[model samples]
Target: MVAQRSPVDLTDRRALLARQPDDPTVLAEAQRLKEVALLDFGIRDSVVASWLYTKCHHHIPTTAVETAAVVATGDGSCLLLYNPQFFVDIGLAGVRFVLFHEARHLMHRHLYAEQELRADPLFHLAAEVSINHVAMVRLQVTGLPSRVVPGKDAGTSHEPVGVDPREVHQRYADDLRDQGREPLSYEEFVDTDLVVYRELKRMRTPLVMPVGLCIHADHVGRHGSEFPADAETVGLIIGEALAEAIRAALRGNRLARDEVLNLIDRSEGGGDRLTRMWGNLGAAALRGETPRTRRVDWWKRWLADTLASKLREGERLVYPKKQGAVLLALGHDPMLSRRGRERTKVVLIALDTSGSMPDEVVDWVTTLVGQTDGVESHWLSFDGVVMPFVPGERVYGGGGTNFQNVVDYAEGRLAIDGVPFEVQPDAVIMVTDGYAPHVTPAQPDRWIWLITNGGDDWPEHHHPPMACHRVTTGDR
Candidate 1:
């Protein structure tokens, strides 16, 4: 069995948090509270959250946040920040609720990144409503955690508590009605997070503004801070976590199954990032058991995620101290400081281009590479010989397939059209029918093989196996 990692030491991670309380007692108490909440999750039926809490770094007594928030760190990992007094005031129940809410927020941010929806204050409110609604129902809490307000009852904050989805829906309905527009039913409104956002967009004025109440709302704009948390980094981290959760669920872990299902049901929507990741996950974990309607051609997603991992390996990314300080202060993830040349990641796509290869496959590859940011892509069409080409420009190759020629050109042993292939790619993707005799590249680990529908997957059975997946026309 693989050894489980020990929980990260908070002292080591505390440096990541800006403006941490100088008082050691306050820090220790906050750590105790955080540990208690995490322990509660472990003992309860929240394996996913428990696992996530263990995976993420945590900092206590952070003045950057009023309550708690999860932000991506500069190192492509996530950090949870919380105010010590807030946790102390809220008690254990509130601590649990807020932690769960922040966990859900991290998941939400990972799943969706639409600029328009993120920019809309209503959407942020809608997200809070949906997240809090789930947290309330799952945790069996009737009311939100409140802190003491001056001139009021000791556990009563005068600030509006807006956790209930139904209450938010009622307010939205009233506003829409006043504007002479129809409103969706509460059930319909709460179908999914995206659905809530879409319905909220119909309203002329939102009853609850999420600006000061939520961290995401406060840090939505650049305002001297470009969206921190490298999108790729967050995507990779969350994808791995979900993939692990899915594996645990599939292995008959009841709690894991329930949490995974809840996440997929509540957060997933058409054409979303999570949808693609889930498709690849379900396909891999469930194999042929996935339903037709939900079955997507997961190869593209699988390939994309695979390429990302391979390319990111062994790369040290850091941010400027000044910029990182500002990002941490705002509860935002700091991006790595890299020059334009250093920022560009190279990928090479080698198409078999034999008669067996389909047009759709090539088009899919073209679109995938073209859409990726900071990726300098090189294209090659290989038959018996290899020829360099660019996307959208057709190259003729009808001869027999030979994998060695492509590998030769990639490793700088062979030249194409008398010009030596000098660009060293971070990863190489070879799309072919896999009919040719397999020859090993110098670095087979850097290579990925895509076999066509009727093609053989020789790479998988090779002496040193390579990452190989079948390319389909579309969804099966």
Candidate 2:
């Protein structure tokens, strides 16, 4: 039997990236490729902005870059953290390769798992989509920007949708499979040979990559005993132990039953998928972070808004600083020196209780909030009107949630006494079913909504400036 990995040392996974040091040239190239991709594509740099790999040869049980992917998954969307540690085999080519791969995962909406995601067809499309996002971007940044992105889903009215994976033929990806040169991820580039010529190559390091990624942000006691489980090297290690998890799961697939039997067999796995899905998606969801160089408040507001904004339009949280510290608390000698300038915030639960609010859902909301720290919140229940209540304060109303009441209550000093709007809140955390006709004008900068879920679809123009996360009351 393969060893069970000594019960996972959470500290050890972190130590893997703990500074050993890397060549200056490899480091420079990775950042360079990223900036080039951004400038070229008009693709917002804020989306998966920078990446780095560990500088040393550390065996990451999995075949991935050696730094954790910083993200805003808790808010309901996909964002990426490209590793900066480089393995220069060909200049930044490998860096570009991985970026393209991960980008495919983002643009194509694989992160949600909100919908059914098959393994191949959409996966293949993700690869092609990135290639196209890059090709169009190159022309835009290097020379004249492209009026049209040559990508598969460029300039579409709706966000790009997922394609059926099983339908995708294998030849598409098989054609680009390593070309027998060895996995490109193992190398990095430092030189530029041809504008479009043959001698293009980068240098290589032994190996370095990241592992044990948690989709949601980890606050105080969310994970509980499983809080720091050692899934790191979980899928990373390549030993028989690693292969064992892989083999066991794959073995379950060996006896391909008929579609009817397979459909019936998926009940538990389906429930688990749902459980794994929005467990943190209730009223307490958040995207935590540290302060930036200066513009502290703006940075915090950006972090909050990005975290809470309705990500359907492509919102992403990109951390310029190191990933580990991004989620650390801010206190003395904290990440940012200007605390006042950078507003720190507590979460607010803005429930639309106008005639729109039903008693059952209200109890549900209170139950969810009760699960966590109750002090970090202010409750506003409104319908064709608005009323802000303190934690435990009681009030009632039922009618159309006049689109402006909740916003009015949240912004005015009435709800939160003595708190200035600027230094006011970090996030609004609206709990609505999206039935409201409209939303309040966002405070130029604030996380207006962190966890937005009710029972209906948001009106087209009713969306707020902040991230609008959607959660449902029923079964997944």
The C-alpha lDDT values of all candidates are: 0.69, 0.33
| Candidate 1 weakest ten by summed lDDT | 1-10
Candidate 2 yields a Cα-based lDDT of 0.33
Q: Give per-residue CA lDDT, model 1, range 34-84, as digits (tens).
A: 766775665564665666665564444575456666656657677766878
lDDT by residue for model 2 over 1-476, one digit each (tens)? Answer: 01112123223445333433466554554555544443222223212212111101122321132322323222222223334443232223333434433433332233333323222223233333333334234222231111212364753322211121112212222323534342222111101101101111111221111112111111111234322212222212212111222222222322211211221222223454332321222100211322122222231222232432322111111233443255343421112111122223355567765434455545655654454332255666666656667756776766665656556655664433544333345455565666655555556345433233334544322443434444433332
Whole-model alpha-carbon lDDT for candidate 1: 0.69
User: Candidate 1: which pairs clash?
Assistant: none
Alpha-carbon runs more than 4 Å astray in model 2: 1-89, 98-343, 354-360, 363-375, 383-385, 398-401, 413-423, 429-440, 443-458, 463-472
Counting clashing residue pairs in each candidate, in order, gives 0, 61
TM-score of candidate 2 to 2 decimals:
0.37
